[model samples]
Target: MDTFVWRDDYSVGYTPIDEQHQELFKRINAFGNALWEGQGKELLAAHLRFLADYVVSHFQTEEGLMTTHKFPLYEVHKPVHDAFVQEVSSVLNRIADAGLDTATAILVFEKSCDWTRAHVRGMDQELGRFLGAQRNSTAA
Candidate 1:
Protein backbone atom coordinates (compact mmCIF):
# COMPACT_ATOMS: atom_id res chain seq x y z
CA MET A 1 0.00 0.00 0.00
CA ASP A 2 2.76 2.41 0.97
CA THR A 3 5.23 3.20 -1.77
CA PHE A 4 8.87 2.60 -0.87
CA VAL A 5 11.38 5.21 -1.92
CA TRP A 6 15.13 5.30 -1.36
CA ARG A 7 16.28 8.03 0.95
CA ASP A 8 19.66 9.55 1.82
CA ASP A 9 19.33 8.24 5.36
CA TYR A 10 19.56 4.70 4.00
CA SER A 11 23.19 4.98 2.88
CA VAL A 12 25.65 2.97 4.96
CA GLY A 13 28.62 5.09 3.82
CA TYR A 14 30.50 2.26 2.09
CA THR A 15 30.41 2.74 -1.65
CA PRO A 16 30.25 -0.89 -2.76
CA ILE A 17 27.73 -1.90 -0.15
CA ASP A 18 25.69 1.21 -0.79
CA GLU A 19 25.56 0.44 -4.47
CA GLN A 20 24.45 -3.11 -3.82
CA HIS A 21 21.80 -1.87 -1.42
CA GLN A 22 20.52 0.53 -4.01
CA GLU A 23 20.33 -2.23 -6.60
CA LEU A 24 18.47 -4.43 -4.18
CA PHE A 25 15.98 -1.66 -3.51
CA LYS A 26 15.53 -1.07 -7.20
CA ARG A 27 14.83 -4.73 -7.91
CA ILE A 28 12.44 -5.07 -5.02
CA ASN A 29 10.59 -1.94 -6.01
CA ALA A 30 10.19 -3.27 -9.52
CA PHE A 31 8.71 -6.46 -8.16
CA GLY A 32 6.35 -4.47 -5.97
CA ASN A 33 5.25 -2.36 -8.89
CA ALA A 34 4.50 -5.42 -10.96
CA LEU A 35 2.31 -6.74 -8.21
CA TRP A 36 0.54 -3.41 -7.75
CA GLU A 37 -0.26 -3.28 -11.43
CA GLY A 38 -2.28 -6.51 -11.09
CA GLN A 39 0.08 -8.29 -13.38
CA GLY A 40 -0.46 -11.86 -14.48
CA LYS A 41 0.57 -14.65 -12.16
CA GLU A 42 3.36 -15.78 -14.46
CA LEU A 43 4.85 -12.30 -14.65
CA LEU A 44 4.66 -11.87 -10.88
CA ALA A 45 6.38 -15.20 -10.34
CA ALA A 46 9.14 -14.25 -12.72
CA HIS A 47 9.77 -10.98 -10.93
CA LEU A 48 9.73 -12.71 -7.57
CA ARG A 49 12.27 -15.24 -8.77
CA PHE A 50 14.47 -12.48 -10.13
CA LEU A 51 14.34 -10.69 -6.79
CA ALA A 52 15.24 -13.86 -4.90
CA ASP A 53 18.21 -14.56 -7.11
CA TYR A 54 19.47 -11.00 -6.84
CA VAL A 55 19.17 -11.02 -3.05
CA VAL A 56 21.18 -14.23 -2.78
CA SER A 57 23.93 -12.94 -5.05
CA HIS A 58 24.11 -9.58 -3.33
CA PHE A 59 24.13 -11.14 0.12
CA GLN A 60 27.04 -13.35 -0.91
CA THR A 61 29.01 -10.32 -1.97
CA GLU A 62 28.22 -8.51 1.25
CA GLU A 63 29.05 -11.53 3.37
CA GLY A 64 32.32 -12.11 1.58
CA LEU A 65 33.39 -8.53 2.13
CA MET A 66 32.57 -8.78 5.82
CA THR A 67 34.56 -11.98 6.13
CA THR A 68 37.56 -10.52 4.31
CA HIS A 69 37.50 -7.45 6.53
CA LYS A 70 37.06 -9.59 9.65
CA PHE A 71 34.11 -7.52 10.71
CA PRO A 72 33.61 -7.86 14.43
CA LEU A 73 29.91 -8.67 14.10
CA TYR A 74 30.15 -11.01 11.13
CA GLU A 75 28.79 -13.88 13.14
CA VAL A 76 25.80 -11.89 14.26
CA HIS A 77 25.27 -10.29 10.88
CA LYS A 78 25.26 -13.47 8.78
CA PRO A 79 22.13 -14.90 10.30
CA VAL A 80 20.21 -11.96 8.90
CA HIS A 81 21.25 -13.03 5.42
CA ASP A 82 20.38 -16.64 6.15
CA ALA A 83 16.96 -15.65 7.43
CA PHE A 84 16.29 -13.64 4.28
CA VAL A 85 17.14 -16.62 2.10
CA GLN A 86 14.78 -18.76 4.09
CA GLU A 87 12.03 -16.17 3.94
CA VAL A 88 12.36 -15.89 0.19
CA SER A 89 12.22 -19.63 -0.16
CA SER A 90 9.06 -19.75 1.92
CA VAL A 91 7.41 -17.06 -0.20
CA LEU A 92 8.29 -18.94 -3.34
CA ASN A 93 6.68 -22.02 -1.92
CA ARG A 94 3.57 -20.09 -1.04
CA ILE A 95 3.40 -18.58 -4.50
CA ALA A 96 3.74 -22.01 -6.02
CA ASP A 97 0.98 -23.42 -3.87
CA ALA A 98 -1.46 -20.50 -3.89
CA GLY A 99 -0.69 -19.15 -7.36
CA LEU A 100 0.53 -15.62 -6.61
CA ASP A 101 -2.56 -13.63 -5.79
CA THR A 102 -1.86 -9.93 -6.13
CA ALA A 103 -2.71 -8.93 -2.60
CA THR A 104 -0.80 -11.74 -0.95
CA ALA A 105 2.17 -11.32 -3.21
CA ILE A 106 2.25 -7.61 -2.54
CA LEU A 107 2.22 -8.19 1.21
CA VAL A 108 5.08 -10.64 1.03
CA PHE A 109 7.01 -8.38 -1.30
CA GLU A 110 6.62 -5.47 1.09
CA LYS A 111 7.88 -7.59 3.95
CA SER A 112 10.97 -8.49 1.95
CA CYS A 113 11.58 -4.83 1.18
CA ASP A 114 11.18 -3.88 4.83
CA TRP A 115 13.59 -6.55 5.96
CA THR A 116 16.21 -5.41 3.47
CA ARG A 117 15.92 -1.77 4.47
CA ALA A 118 16.21 -2.63 8.14
CA HIS A 119 19.20 -4.91 7.62
CA VAL A 120 21.00 -2.32 5.53
CA ARG A 121 20.34 0.45 7.99
CA GLY A 122 21.18 -1.56 11.07
CA MET A 123 23.73 -4.33 10.41
CA ASP A 124 25.32 -3.08 7.20
CA GLN A 125 25.65 0.44 8.50
CA GLU A 126 27.49 -0.80 11.57
CA LEU A 127 29.74 -2.96 9.45
CA GLY A 128 30.54 0.04 7.27
CA ARG A 129 31.57 2.04 10.29
CA PHE A 130 33.72 -0.80 11.58
CA LEU A 131 35.43 -1.30 8.26
CA GLY A 132 36.01 2.40 7.80
CA ALA A 133 37.52 2.70 11.25
CA GLN A 134 39.76 -0.28 10.62
CA ARG A 135 41.00 1.18 7.37
CA ASN A 136 41.66 4.55 8.95
CA SER A 137 43.46 3.01 11.88
CA THR A 138 45.66 0.93 9.64
CA ALA A 139 46.49 3.95 7.51
CA ALA A 140 47.60 5.93 10.54
Candidate 2:
Protein backbone atom coordinates (compact mmCIF):
# COMPACT_ATOMS: atom_id res chain seq x y z
CA MET A 1 0.00 0.00 0.00
CA ASP A 2 1.24 3.46 -0.86
CA THR A 3 1.24 5.78 2.12
CA PHE A 4 -0.60 9.05 1.99
CA VAL A 5 1.81 11.96 1.77
CA TRP A 6 1.06 15.39 3.19
CA ARG A 7 1.40 17.99 0.53
CA ASP A 8 2.08 21.66 1.25
CA ASP A 9 -1.19 22.64 -0.42
CA TYR A 10 -3.17 20.76 2.19
CA SER A 11 -2.21 23.15 4.99
CA VAL A 12 -5.04 24.95 6.78
CA GLY A 13 -2.99 28.13 7.39
CA TYR A 14 -2.83 27.55 11.15
CA THR A 15 0.21 26.27 12.92
CA PRO A 16 -1.47 23.92 15.36
CA ILE A 17 -3.92 22.45 12.90
CA ASP A 18 -1.25 22.14 10.25
CA GLU A 19 1.01 20.33 12.66
CA GLN A 20 -1.73 17.95 13.65
CA HIS A 21 -2.57 17.33 10.02
CA GLN A 22 1.03 16.42 9.37
CA GLU A 23 1.00 14.09 12.33
CA LEU A 24 -2.12 12.42 10.98
CA PHE A 25 -0.42 11.87 7.66
CA LYS A 26 2.49 10.32 9.47
CA ARG A 27 0.25 8.03 11.49
CA ILE A 28 -1.68 6.92 8.46
CA ASN A 29 1.55 6.29 6.64
CA ALA A 30 2.77 4.20 9.53
CA PHE A 31 -0.46 2.26 9.46
CA GLY A 32 0.01 1.61 5.77
CA ASN A 33 3.59 0.53 6.28
CA ALA A 34 2.48 -1.92 8.93
CA LEU A 35 -0.17 -3.30 6.63
CA TRP A 36 2.33 -3.72 3.81
CA GLU A 37 4.85 -5.40 6.04
CA GLY A 38 2.28 -7.87 7.35
CA GLN A 39 2.94 -6.83 10.92
CA GLY A 40 1.13 -8.43 13.84
CA LYS A 41 -2.42 -7.50 14.72
CA GLU A 42 -1.19 -5.71 17.84
CA LEU A 43 0.87 -3.30 15.76
CA LEU A 44 -2.09 -2.58 13.52
CA ALA A 45 -4.27 -2.10 16.59
CA ALA A 46 -1.83 0.47 17.94
CA HIS A 47 -2.11 2.54 14.78
CA LEU A 48 -5.88 2.30 14.89
CA ARG A 49 -5.85 3.40 18.50
CA PHE A 50 -3.74 6.38 17.58
CA LEU A 51 -6.20 7.25 14.84
CA ALA A 52 -9.10 7.00 17.27
CA ASP A 53 -7.35 9.19 19.82
CA TYR A 54 -6.28 11.74 17.23
CA VAL A 55 -9.80 12.13 15.90
CA VAL A 56 -10.98 13.17 19.33
CA SER A 57 -8.07 15.43 20.20
CA HIS A 58 -7.79 17.03 16.80
CA PHE A 59 -11.51 17.68 16.57
CA GLN A 60 -11.48 19.36 19.94
CA THR A 61 -8.65 21.61 18.88
CA GLU A 62 -10.44 22.63 15.68
CA GLU A 63 -13.82 23.06 17.35
CA GLY A 64 -12.30 25.08 20.17
CA LEU A 65 -10.75 27.39 17.64
CA MET A 66 -14.09 27.82 15.96
CA THR A 67 -15.78 28.52 19.28
CA THR A 68 -13.15 30.99 20.49
CA HIS A 69 -13.09 32.89 17.24
CA LYS A 70 -16.89 33.05 17.18
CA PHE A 71 -16.93 31.51 13.78
CA PRO A 72 -20.47 31.90 12.45
CA LEU A 73 -20.49 28.41 10.98
CA TYR A 74 -19.73 26.66 14.22
CA GLU A 75 -23.03 24.83 14.42
CA VAL A 76 -22.86 23.61 10.85
CA HIS A 77 -19.18 22.82 11.12
CA LYS A 78 -19.56 20.67 14.21
CA PRO A 79 -21.93 18.19 12.66
CA VAL A 80 -19.34 17.52 9.99
CA HIS A 81 -16.87 16.76 12.72
CA ASP A 82 -19.42 14.61 14.48
CA ALA A 83 -20.15 12.64 11.35
CA PHE A 84 -16.46 12.01 10.79
CA VAL A 85 -16.02 10.88 14.37
CA GLN A 86 -18.89 8.51 13.89
CA GLU A 87 -17.34 7.10 10.76
CA VAL A 88 -13.97 6.56 12.39
CA SER A 89 -15.59 5.13 15.46
CA SER A 90 -17.52 2.73 13.30
CA VAL A 91 -14.31 1.50 11.70
CA LEU A 92 -12.73 1.12 15.10
CA ASN A 93 -15.68 -0.87 16.23
CA ARG A 94 -15.48 -3.05 13.16
CA ILE A 95 -11.88 -3.79 13.96
CA ALA A 96 -12.90 -4.82 17.45
CA ASP A 97 -15.62 -7.08 16.12
CA ALA A 98 -13.82 -8.58 13.12
CA GLY A 99 -10.14 -8.31 13.96
CA LEU A 100 -7.51 -6.53 11.85
CA ASP A 101 -8.06 -8.46 8.66
CA THR A 102 -7.13 -7.13 5.26
CA ALA A 103 -10.58 -5.85 4.35
CA THR A 104 -10.99 -4.09 7.66
CA ALA A 105 -7.59 -2.45 7.44
CA ILE A 106 -8.24 -1.35 3.90
CA LEU A 107 -11.57 0.11 4.87
CA VAL A 108 -9.99 2.13 7.66
CA PHE A 109 -7.18 3.39 5.45
CA GLU A 110 -9.41 4.36 2.55
CA LYS A 111 -11.95 6.11 4.72
CA SER A 112 -9.27 8.07 6.57
CA CYS A 113 -7.59 9.19 3.39
CA ASP A 114 -10.83 10.18 1.73
CA TRP A 115 -12.19 12.13 4.70
CA THR A 116 -8.92 13.94 5.36
CA ARG A 117 -8.67 15.19 1.79
CA ALA A 118 -12.28 16.28 1.45
CA HIS A 119 -12.57 17.93 4.87
CA VAL A 120 -9.29 19.80 4.62
CA ARG A 121 -9.96 21.02 1.10
CA GLY A 122 -13.56 21.98 1.74
CA MET A 123 -14.48 22.93 5.32
CA ASP A 124 -11.00 23.56 6.74
CA GLN A 125 -9.92 25.80 3.90
CA GLU A 126 -12.97 27.93 4.51
CA LEU A 127 -12.11 28.18 8.18
CA GLY A 128 -8.58 29.11 7.32
CA ARG A 129 -9.78 31.88 5.03
CA PHE A 130 -12.09 33.20 7.70
CA LEU A 131 -9.29 33.15 10.25
CA GLY A 132 -6.93 34.91 7.87
CA ALA A 133 -9.53 37.58 7.21
CA GLN A 134 -10.14 38.00 10.91
CA ARG A 135 -6.45 38.46 11.55
CA ASN A 136 -6.13 40.98 8.77
CA SER A 137 -9.06 43.04 10.00
CA THR A 138 -7.81 42.99 13.55
CA ALA A 139 -4.38 44.08 12.38
CA ALA A 140 -5.82 46.92 10.35
Candidate 3:
Protein backbone atom coordinates (compact mmCIF):
# COMPACT_ATOMS: atom_id res chain seq x y z
CA MET A 1 0.00 0.00 0.00
CA ASP A 2 1.19 3.51 -0.77
CA THR A 3 0.75 4.95 2.70
CA PHE A 4 -1.36 8.01 3.22
CA VAL A 5 0.91 11.03 3.13
CA TRP A 6 -0.26 14.27 4.58
CA ARG A 7 0.46 17.12 2.24
CA ASP A 8 0.15 20.81 2.99
CA ASP A 9 -2.49 20.78 0.31
CA TYR A 10 -4.54 18.51 2.53
CA SER A 11 -5.02 21.17 5.14
CA VAL A 12 -8.57 22.41 5.39
CA GLY A 13 -7.43 25.73 6.87
CA TYR A 14 -9.23 24.66 10.03
CA THR A 15 -7.04 23.48 12.82
CA PRO A 16 -9.36 20.86 14.29
CA ILE A 17 -10.34 19.36 10.96
CA ASP A 18 -6.76 19.30 9.69
CA GLU A 19 -5.56 17.72 12.90
CA GLN A 20 -8.19 15.01 12.71
CA HIS A 21 -7.32 14.39 9.08
CA GLN A 22 -3.68 13.93 10.00
CA GLU A 23 -4.62 11.61 12.83
CA LEU A 24 -6.59 9.48 10.39
CA PHE A 25 -3.51 9.13 8.20
CA LYS A 26 -1.35 8.32 11.18
CA ARG A 27 -3.70 5.53 12.24
CA ILE A 28 -3.80 4.16 8.71
CA ASN A 29 0.00 4.11 8.59
CA ALA A 30 0.19 2.34 11.92
CA PHE A 31 -2.24 -0.28 10.67
CA GLY A 32 -0.23 -0.66 7.50
CA ASN A 33 2.89 -1.24 9.55
CA ALA A 34 1.08 -4.01 11.41
CA LEU A 35 0.15 -5.57 8.08
CA TRP A 36 3.76 -5.33 7.00
CA GLU A 37 4.69 -7.32 10.08
CA GLY A 38 2.17 -10.03 9.12
CA GLN A 39 -0.25 -9.24 11.91
CA GLY A 40 -3.02 -8.15 9.60
CA LYS A 41 -5.58 -10.86 10.30
CA GLU A 42 -5.30 -10.84 14.04
CA LEU A 43 -5.63 -7.08 14.15
CA LEU A 44 -7.95 -6.36 11.23
CA ALA A 45 -11.25 -6.36 13.04
CA ALA A 46 -10.02 -4.21 15.90
CA HIS A 47 -8.43 -1.80 13.49
CA LEU A 48 -11.57 -1.49 11.42
CA ARG A 49 -13.69 -0.93 14.50
CA PHE A 50 -11.31 1.68 15.79
CA LEU A 51 -11.25 3.39 12.42
CA ALA A 52 -15.01 3.34 12.15
CA ASP A 53 -15.37 4.83 15.62
CA TYR A 54 -12.72 7.45 15.00
CA VAL A 55 -14.33 8.43 11.73
CA VAL A 56 -17.64 8.93 13.47
CA SER A 57 -15.96 11.17 15.99
CA HIS A 58 -14.34 13.19 13.25
CA PHE A 59 -17.61 13.43 11.36
CA GLN A 60 -19.34 14.72 14.45
CA THR A 61 -16.75 17.44 14.75
CA GLU A 62 -17.32 18.50 11.18
CA GLU A 63 -21.08 18.35 11.52
CA GLY A 64 -20.95 20.45 14.65
CA LEU A 65 -18.83 23.05 12.97
CA MET A 66 -21.13 23.18 9.99
CA THR A 67 -24.21 23.56 12.12
CA THR A 68 -22.59 26.17 14.28
CA HIS A 69 -21.45 28.16 11.28
CA LYS A 70 -24.67 27.57 9.37
CA PHE A 71 -22.82 26.10 6.39
CA PRO A 72 -25.08 25.78 3.39
CA LEU A 73 -23.72 22.43 2.35
CA TYR A 74 -24.33 20.54 5.57
CA GLU A 75 -27.32 18.77 4.12
CA VAL A 76 -25.37 17.52 1.13
CA HIS A 77 -22.17 16.82 3.07
CA LYS A 78 -23.59 14.85 6.00
CA PRO A 79 -25.21 12.19 3.88
CA VAL A 80 -21.82 11.46 2.37
CA HIS A 81 -20.47 10.82 5.82
CA ASP A 82 -23.44 8.60 6.55
CA ALA A 83 -22.74 6.59 3.43
CA PHE A 84 -19.12 6.06 4.43
CA VAL A 85 -20.19 4.94 7.85
CA GLN A 86 -22.51 2.43 6.27
CA GLU A 87 -19.75 1.23 3.97
CA VAL A 88 -17.44 0.69 6.90
CA SER A 89 -20.18 -1.15 8.72
CA SER A 90 -20.67 -3.40 5.72
CA VAL A 91 -16.96 -4.15 5.49
CA LEU A 92 -16.81 -4.94 9.15
CA ASN A 93 -19.62 -7.44 8.71
CA ARG A 94 -17.94 -8.97 5.66
CA ILE A 95 -14.71 -9.39 7.52
CA ALA A 96 -16.53 -11.00 10.38
CA ASP A 97 -18.27 -13.42 8.06
CA ALA A 98 -15.45 -14.40 5.70
CA GLY A 99 -12.36 -13.96 7.86
CA LEU A 100 -10.28 -11.52 5.83
CA ASP A 101 -6.79 -12.09 4.50
CA THR A 102 -3.87 -9.69 4.28
CA ALA A 103 -4.84 -8.72 0.76
CA THR A 104 -8.37 -7.75 1.74
CA ALA A 105 -7.08 -5.83 4.72
CA ILE A 106 -4.81 -3.88 2.43
CA LEU A 107 -7.72 -3.12 0.12
CA VAL A 108 -9.65 -1.68 3.05
CA PHE A 109 -6.75 0.55 3.88
CA GLU A 110 -6.33 1.67 0.30
CA LYS A 111 -9.99 2.45 -0.21
CA SER A 112 -10.15 4.47 2.99
CA CYS A 113 -7.00 6.37 2.16
CA ASP A 114 -8.25 7.11 -1.33
CA TRP A 115 -11.63 8.26 -0.02
CA THR A 116 -10.08 10.60 2.53
CA ARG A 117 -7.72 12.19 0.04
CA ALA A 118 -10.54 12.83 -2.38
CA HIS A 119 -12.94 14.07 0.28
CA VAL A 120 -10.38 16.42 1.74
CA ARG A 121 -9.36 17.71 -1.66
CA GLY A 122 -12.94 18.24 -2.67
CA MET A 123 -15.70 19.17 -0.21
CA ASP A 124 -13.46 19.74 2.79
CA GLN A 125 -11.49 22.35 0.87
CA GLU A 126 -14.67 24.16 0.10
CA LEU A 127 -15.57 23.92 3.79
CA GLY A 128 -12.20 25.30 4.73
CA ARG A 129 -12.67 28.29 2.47
CA PHE A 130 -16.10 28.92 3.89
CA LEU A 131 -14.93 28.67 7.49
CA GLY A 132 -11.90 30.85 6.80
CA ALA A 133 -14.09 33.50 5.30
CA GLN A 134 -16.38 33.29 8.27
CA ARG A 135 -13.47 33.69 10.64
CA ASN A 136 -12.13 36.62 8.72
CA SER A 137 -15.48 38.35 8.59
CA THR A 138 -16.00 37.89 12.31
CA ALA A 139 -12.54 39.24 13.06
CA ALA A 140 -13.08 42.21 10.78
Query: Whose TM-score is greatest here?
Result: 3
Cα RMSD (angstroms) for every candidate in the order listed: 1.9, 1.7, 1.7
Runs off by more than 4 Å, candidate 3: 97-99
lDDT of 3 at 98: 57
TM-score of each: 0.91, 0.91, 0.92
Deviation from native of the Cα of residue 64 in model 2, angstroms: 0.2
lDDT of 1 by residue, 86-119 (tens): 9888889878755677877877787887787788
Clashing pairs in 2: none
TM-score of 3: 0.92
lDDT of 3 at 76: 93
Query: Where does model 1 exceed 4 Å of error?
Result: none
Order the candidates by lDDT, highest first: 3, 1, 2
- The lDDT values for all models are 0.84, 0.83, 0.86
* Candidates 1 and 3, the one with greater lDDT: 3
